[model samples]
Target chain A: MRSWLRSEDSWAVLTGLLVLLLGLLSLAGVNALGWVPKANEWTTPLKAVSPASKAFALPGGVSVLLLYTSLLGFLCLGAWRMGHSVKRFAVGFTVLFAVGYGCWVLGHYAHLATTPNKMAEKGITWGLGLTSESGYLLALTAGLLVGNFFPKAGEWLRESARTEWYIKTAIVIIGGVYGFKAAEDVKLTQTVLVRGLAAIIEAYLIYWAVVYFLARKVFGFSREWAVPLASGISICGVSAAITTGAAVRARPVVPVMVSSLVVLFSVVELILLPFAAKLFLTDEPMVAAAWMGLAVKTDGAAFSSGAITAGLLTDDPAQQQAMGLTTSTVKVFIDLFIGVWAVVLAVVWAYGVDRKPGQGVPLKDIWGRFPKFVFGYVLAFAGLLALGLWLTDPVAKKAVKEGMEQADQLRRVFFVLTFFAIGMGANLRRLWAEGLGKLALVYAISLFGFVIWFGLLVSWLFFHGVKPPTVGGN
Target chain B: MPDDKRTAEELAKQQAEPLLPAEKWLIFGSISLGLALLGVLLWLTGAM
Candidate 1:
């Protein structure tokens, strides 16, 4: 119980809600989050940074400093409680934030990130047009260089490089954004949420069955190996693999091996799938969003893929936000099922597959396996949603949006950190040296030959013909 | 039937034993099917 209380998951929820609470102070007419830094597209360095809100008219560098200090303090508090070396973490996080945010500012250069619509005014004939979120890709690439080439730096930074916690915090902040959008158009937002739930359920059942069969019959893996592999590849990646591993009483090595592969492949999917979705599914934006949630494995990679795909597929900020919300909604629904599915697997393995005398299903493991950070996500979302619905005054509604805007900017900062952390944690040489030939082959075949296409089909079935509400239109 | 076919059938059934208790499969299948139906209904109503 003590260990669970101090776990990274619990800290992530607490940290995330603390940020949201500060932002929520806008309801009382104090924009506590307004000083958060935002990077804007610019031809020159001087024009690139600003306070997230016009109300806090601090100089750009000051805004960045405020952001850094607050994040360092908030994260260090968690590190201290979680039994990490707070001094080392603070130092490592400082360097990481500097380098990561530097790449983010570079990605905001006019020639690299300016969209087509703004190209004319910027006097550039063409730009990469990846949108401001290009910072995520830039941060990822820069971190990969540090990880693969600068082994000493990677080791030094390892104590603070927490990809999952960063992404979960970002997710909770995004839930607030979703709630604000919901207030704007309840019917549309609810539809996206409902479709996302249905799509994940339909896709998961088929995905698990097919992958399990393929691993068992085609790859000729044993049940112990196949069950966790299927769940890892078919469900929410590392968490699902670990939970299913415990459920089936597999050796720890089984889930650990599956987890490394999931991370590597999730990064690969993050890099590749967004472009493919943009190319093939651009017209059906919601389908593309759902596809990203289902096809990408890890939460960080999945949410990042959604943002990149949304950036590529549209110029409208409203549409891009909607795409991201749809993706998160689907992924969260999938996350909700990990505990339930763990129980199902436990029951089956205990009674049917490898039952031994005195071996009972570990039903209590379900609660242990539940993703704790999801509570923060749901709370932020529901709180903002209830406030949106209850507030009748237009003035109050505008303040709510203003507050959420600050939270959204902070979410982007966490996302950039997540991208860099994910890249740094991916050790290509280690994955290669581990003799993962059969398992890699199975993942390749199952993912490319079956899972991706099946996910696209399921997404299309549920989300076809649905479009997000255009700006100012419901 | 050929001897090989008979052997394969026996092997298949033996391998399938763990997945028995067809009731479990039935319940999961019904849930999935119901969700699919709900999706279609929602789509038809433009509520999903």
Candidate 2:
């Protein structure tokens, strides 16, 4: 027991668990007390006001600003500790935060409300209510930023036994929201199945082929760096890359570059995709949702895009929900492939670099290296789905649903905090010393390849003669 | 002899000299400028 506690990995895990708990607690407290800002309140800063009026607003405004202040404090601390490398991390974090914040703001402006009350009333939830969902997101962002500043503090926040329980519980709750029952409702045609599989395969192939060639020939990046970058960009973005990098024992700079590129491109895609869908697509929510899911690398980006598109294209509440669910479900499916892709990349790297038959790492070792928490995530999701389906009673379903929603919200909050912590740990000097030329080339190749494959396969399978499943419609 | 040669290689690798501070700054500045330009372009195109 003492030995287990002494392990560095164990400590990190413990820290993560605690942080997850804090996030959950904060989420529950914020939700219950209504600490989140309403849509209208978000716009308050932009409103014309006299000096006298502004004075009264200042107090409330200052509270709102606390979140940003905490984030800045965390950044400063991380910079101080991490030294020269801190700059790169700061840049990456800033890009990610800016994009995420922009999306939240845009989503609010678009009036994309998922709650039943707003849906039924067909009115926007307004004001700077501290209990609003957006407010919670803001708070989570702030918490993460603060966490990033002090690694020890961040670890402590994440590692408590309570946080571990909360994280697992949250994952279970999010499962219900994913609608596992709805999974069967959508008929899987040969076409749909083929398209999905094809998209996955093509995405992988394009990523590897393009990134490999560019990294080796154009950028002169070591194969070690190229493999992880390609895996990350082509699969689930930063998370996938980080996991694979750890598994293969790639240099730290490789993962950093991959993460930075992922953040940059993710933001670009988030802003670009919605507008593109609006302009080009036929205003079919499912089609738009599918497009967003297939094109965007991350679930959050896909969901935000889907929500915005749904708001613009449809007035039907059911349709909006369906779109949101579809985008999320698709992205989660893509996320599941991260482990498989990472393992495969690990094998390739081992054999290619070491040039030994049976001398490469055993499959068991690779399996051990894989991130295990992801399974907990999957289990939680699956559990929710089963519970949602088996429990026929409306009251019970509602209760379960609410529980899941709270948990899902908590998980997202913790994830944001984790990202903030990562940003704080980043170092710019190390990145610069390594030379960005190679990294940039790898990123460009991977991104370009992914976009091409995603666009082509999605269009060919779903858009061109084939019809995909709808939520309620046959 | 092999050990000596390996040590020489290690020494050479270590002695491969890092970029000058001025050169490093120039590279960083160029990258920042490029990113800024890209951001501006994105904004102008209403992609932001």
Q: Which candidate number has the best TM-score?
A: 1
Q: Each candidate's iRMS in angstroms?
A: 11.6, 15.1
Interface RMSD of 2: 15.1
lDDT of 2: 0.46
lDDT (tens digit, per residue) of candidate 1 on A1-474: 667657788877877887778888888999898899999998989989999889887999999998999999989988888898999999999988998888889889999999888999987898989888789999999778888899789989988898888999999889888877777778778778777766556545767867877777676676777877998898899888888888888876777777877888898899999999878997999899999998999889999999999988997878888898899888888888888788878877777776787888776665676677777788878888888889999988888788888888888889999999998988776445434556777887888888889788878877888897677764
lDDT of 1 by residue, B1-48 (tens): 123333234323434323345324634574566466655755665642
Candidate 2 Cα deviation (angstroms), residue A295: 3.2
Write the residue-wise lDDT of candidate 2 on A308-349 in tens digits. 565555545455555555555555566666667666555555
Docking class of 2: incorrect
Off by over 4 Å in 1: A1-4, B1-48
> TM-score for each prediction?
0.91, 0.56
**Worst window of 10 by summed lDDT in candidate 1 chain A:** A429-438
